[model samples]
Target: WQVFRFAAPALMAGNAALLKHASNVCGSALEIEAVFREAGFPKDLFRVLLIESGEVAALIARPEIRAVTLTGSNRAGESVGAAAGKALKKTVLELGGSDPYVILADADVEHAVQVTVQSRLTNSGQSCIAAKRFIVVPEVREAFERGVVERMKLASCGDPMLESTQVGPLARLDLREGLHRQVRESVAAGARLILGGEIPSGPGAFYPPTVLSEVKPGMPAYDEEIFGPVAAIIPVKDEEAAIAVANDTSFGLGAAVFTRDLARGEKIAKERIEAGSCFVNALVKSDPRLPFGGIKESGYGREL
Candidate 1:
């Protein structure tokens, strides 16, 4: 979806595109290129480059390469932006995110929980706009935690080919290990593991839907983007504190506020949420009709 998000618009604008896909997904990238060719578009109009990350600088430096678009970590964005800037090239970067999902005291708890679970678990929670932080008012904190844990416990994990499978393995074993490390460090930092922190003994890169409670500053679960099926629940005293915690992060990709008070929610979402897109009583998602991007350390420029 991401590969096509940027490519489709560029192609529609009659601009040639050179895609530098994530190394691990090279086959998928090639498939996209093949599809375009089979559809009778000129072959030269679309190309996929399978090259090492180190080779990107040279590619960007080429005079023919007018622009660059990257969707990756902050580290990759920094390198790509640097190379593109040095060559006076236009660059679009959609990097890391620690998006906050705020649950106000007056919110519909059931609806909020449902949206929260779906948003946090979409794409196995490996998404830039996925709800990484759950900021809840103290009055409903316990209820929210319980609801999240119940939904997570019901998640079925196995081969993604199976229609019944709700959760699948990570893209790679190294990614699974990295997520486990973040879980371990967060637990050690005093966050309570409410559910699913274990790395299952299996052939594939499988990790269960994990939930962390009492997440606060100084903990990885609270401070960093854990790009997996891990939910960090941080309880605050009120709306002021909830907004404070939401804006505390350096990444400002997307954010959501859940409240029955429509006027209050909209006011806060528009005026206080420091993100590219803010939603009231809903999960943050990218729509074709609206622009998608991030601010602060997440990245810059819009995608779709």
Candidate 2:
């Protein structure tokens, strides 16, 4: 609700907003519309467009729609951005991320463990900044491995409807299959799977939360983001190597640094991280008070 936390006041400030969420979250979308209506917003003040991806451009091209904001794939953002551009209108996008999570030799093991465990489990690891890349310095690799393994073992993997479930199925069938393919290809490219390599046998589109170790550059997994529960762990020899590996990917969405040395963290935060937002000594999470966006193929513009 962080979004609504700040956006509600903005909405009340006379500027209306429309939301076109993921098709799977229709119920939540409509309920958001209801909240605005109940708050005495004009019927036209808050609109929910339950539209398909194939038709977003047409909707955004409407003469009344002055600006458009979108959150999804880079392809989707390009389409919407192009359409809005053609209309000579403003458009903002919060596109997908292949964010990196880095831990230097001086990192706090327990702190990194707690944060990485929580980062990978956020929104069941379907989040944009959910720590897709786990880069650790060699000196701390074994301890980080042990820490992550212990925590991963503790992650509840079962029905989302269950109160104790920490991991759930991917959002849709295609998402499941695509992530599975990434796993297969990444493994084929010599990436070692310390955890979760196979698909879970199930009726729903469920994929077990997975972690990969010995992730080196040149693998397809390194080149692209796996948009599910799978996390790729990369170990580097030094902080420079870690920074190089972290920035090697095309994505520049969010980058995180976990280290005890505040000076080094500040240096990386200011100079090394190639992202719209960089977090020092913390995992990245979006906020309504600050704008969030991406650079490179992750897409462009901002959203708050």
Candidate 3:
């Protein structure tokens, strides 16, 4: 949010701003309007349309909306993209990622392992760039796998309304269904499980942190992004193989390489990644100033 305070002026310069906030955060939508209104923006110049889902298409197709910016589901991105495409409106999509977290042999063993686990479950694993896949080198694969699984099991999922809850509820019921389906598909495809595949006992949509090893390509767990606390631990022979496994996914939204070797980090960041963004020594995600998007089916437009 701090980034936006600085970035919005530079990016929105000479361009009218149109915002489509997430469905659940209407209060945030109104707050955005208040900010613009407080800035003395003309009523007509800054409009926040909190309309029915069906009405979004009409608004996007209007001549007034010259460009579209979105930070939400990939499915939502497709609908917005279609409307914008039809109306010839420019689109900026900050689609969330099923990002990969790569751990090379030369990576700092303890720090890399700890951060990998943390990144996987950060934001209740709700982040687009929360490290979804943990790709580890052969030498450290067993250690990394054990470390991640242990940490996952220790994740304290409970009431978000609680002060100490580490994991919160899904935004809604349907999202939990989607996550459950993904988990089921992965298991059916024969991926080895490490921990937490079932929903915890609660009214809230809570799944314990899940860990899987021997995640071969083509398995639902390997190819698809598990949006929950599910972790896919894929083994690679060396740095080159790690890069290959990292790039194998349709998503190149972001990547993290944990290695002291700065040169190898550069190579992975420059040559191996298919993502619009890359993180050499840290886990990857989006920011307001730095643009975020993906290649292939992930979407084309960048968000800044």
Candidate 4:
């Protein structure tokens, strides 16, 4: 999606494209290039390079490269942005996020819970803009937690190719291990495991939908981006506290606030929340019509 998002604009603007995709998704990369060729694009105009990661810096530094764009972690973004900067080339980076999904006291609890379950578990929660943090007012904290756990349990976990599989495996075994490490550390740091904390005994890189309650500052679930099917629920006293907690993270990619009062949700989502994209009574998503990016350590420059 990101590859096309940026490539489409560049192609429309009469610029060529060179894609160096993630090693795990090489087939998809080749298919994208094939699609462009079949669509009447000049063969040389759109290309996919199966190059080693070490070769990327030199490629970006080439005079003909002109510009660079990346979608990955902050560490990877820093490395790419630095190389591009040294080459004095334009660059766009879309990095990791720990987006906040706030449920206000006046929110429709059922609606918020359903949308949040969908948003957080989409792509097995591997998305950069997925709502990782759940900040709910004290009045509805227990109800939100219960609803989330019950709803999350219903998500079928198995092979992604199966249409009924709602929660699929992580992209790799290492990614699943890393996510479990975060979950373990957070649990040790006092974040209570509400449901699905155990890694299932299986062959594939599958993990169940896990939820952590009472997550607060100092826990990895609170501070770091858990790029897997894990949910961190943090309870706050009031709206002001909710906003304060939402803005507490270093990454500012996206956020959401659910409230029956549209005016109040708007004020907090548009003005108070510290994120590039904020939604009121809805989930955050990337639309072709809107510019998508992040602020602070998340990334800089827009993609679509």
Candidate 5:
């Protein structure tokens, strides 16, 4: 999705693309290049450079490399952005996010919980726009938490190749370890662990769907992006406090609001939430027809 989002427009404009995909996904990168080639695009029009991270600086310094775009961690974005700045090349970066899902007082608790859990567990919670924080108003917080825990517990982690697998192992072992560390630290910091927080003994890098309630500002669950299947539930006093908690994060990638009242949901999604894309009664997602990307540390510029 990231490759095609930028490649389609650049190809249309008659500009070539040089992709430097993540080190672990080299085969997928080559497959993408082959896809363009098979579709009759010029042989060299879309090229994959299987290069090391240290080599990126020299590659960006090359005069033939026009604009640069990346979808990765903030650290990678900072490195690429610095190199691009030095080379005076136009750049677009789509970085990490900890998107918030706000559940209003009048929201259908069941529907909200279903959507929130599904969003949070998407891609084993690897996606940048995957909902991370669940900010619920006092009226529905208890029920919302209960529903979320039940739904999350139902998700079975297994081989991704199996159609029955709702959740799979994370992409790397280090990521699973990092996520577990966050869960532990958060729990020690007073965040209530209401569901699976254990690292299962398995062959693959699997972490179970975990839930942490009473997540506050100082906890890792609240302050950092948990890039795995973990849901952080934050309780807010009312609508005003919910919105405040939702916007308190440095990320401005994607957010969603759930409410029974359509007008109220729309109003909050449009005017109250601070994000590049805000949705009402749905999980925030990217579509080919709509503009995508984010702001603040989540990065600037748009893609779709």
Candidate 6:
């Protein structure tokens, strides 16, 4: 999706695309080039380069490469942005996010929980716009927590190739370890572990659907992005507190607000929540017709 989002427009504008994809997904990148070829586009119009990260700076410095765009972690974004700036080239960065979902008192508890769990577990919670911090008012916090735990617990974690697998392993073992470390540190810092928090005894990099409640500002679950199937639930006093908590993070990629009143939801989404894409009652998603990007440390410029 990310590749096509940029490649489609560039090709339509008669520009060739050079894809230097992440090493872990090299197979998919090759397949994408093959897809472009099979679709009857000119050969060599879209090409994939299997190169090391260190080689990118030199490639960007070349005059042939017009602009640079990246979708990765903050560290990688910083490196690429620095290189592109040195080369005096245009750049677009779609980096990390710790998206928040605000649940008000009037929201249907069941519906909010269903959507929150779905958003959190999408791509095994590896998405930049996946719901990370769930801020709920006191009126619905307990009910929302209970419902989220039940729904998350029901998700089946297994092989990605299986149709029955609702959850899959992390992309790498180090990533799983990093996510587990965050969960442990967050719990040690006073977050309550209400659901799966342990690393399962498995052959794959599979972490269970974990839930942490009472997530506060200092804890990792509250402070950093957990790139796995872990949900952080933060309880706030009222609507004002909820909004404050939602915007407390440095990331401003995406956010959602749930309320029974459509007008109230829209107002909060439009005015209160700080994000590039704000959804009133649905999960934050990317559409080709709408611009997709982030603000603050989440990076700059739109993709589609």
Q: Pick by lDDT: which candidate is best?
A: 6
TM-score of each: 0.98, 0.93, 0.89, 0.99, 0.98, 0.99
Model 3 misplaced stretches (Cα beyond 4 Å) = 1-7, 10-16, 35-46, 161-163, 287-289
Candidate 1 per-residue C-alpha lDDT over 187-282 given as tens digits, one digit per residue, 9 for 90 to 100: 999999999999888599989999999998999899889899999999898889999999999999999999999999999999999998999878
Name the weakest run of 10 consecutive residues (lDDT summed) in model 3.
2-11
Model 4 residue 19 distance off true place after TM-score fit, in angstroms: 0.5
Whole-model Cα lDDT of every candidate shown, in order:
0.91, 0.81, 0.76, 0.93, 0.93, 0.94
lDDT of 4 by residue, 79-148 (tens): 9999999999999999999999999998999999999999899899899988899999999998999999
Tally clashing residue pairs in candidate 3.
Answer: 2
Q: After superposition, how far is residue 37 of candidate 2 from its true place, in Å?
A: 1.6
> Which RMSD does model 1 reach against the true structure?
0.9
Model 6 stretches astray by more than 4 angstroms:
none
lDDT (0-100) at residue 259 of candidate 2?
93
Cα lDDT tens digits, model 5, 1-304, are 7899999988999899999999889999999999999999977999999889999999999999889999999999999999999999998999999999999888989999989999999999999999999999889998999999999999988999998998999998988889999999999999999999998885999999999999999999999988999999999888999899999988899999998899988888888888999999899899989878998899988875
Q: Which prediction has more favorable lDDT, 3 or 6?
A: 6
Candidate 2 lDDT: 0.81
The C-alpha stretches of model 5 lying farther than 4 A from their native spots are none
lDDT (10s digit) by residue, model 2, range 1-304? 6336435755767677777777789898888888878988788788877888778777778887777767778777778889889888787677778888889998998899888778877877888888888899989999998888778877888889899999888889898888889888888889888787677775888787677888887776677877877778898989899999889988888988999999989889889889989898788887767877778777777766
In candidate 2, the residue pairs with backbone N, CA or C atoms under 3 Å apart (3 or more residues apart, or in different chains) clash, namely: none
For model 6, what is the alpha-carbon lDDT of residue 64? 98
Question: Where does the lowest 10-residue lDDT sum fall in candidate 6?
Answer: 272-281
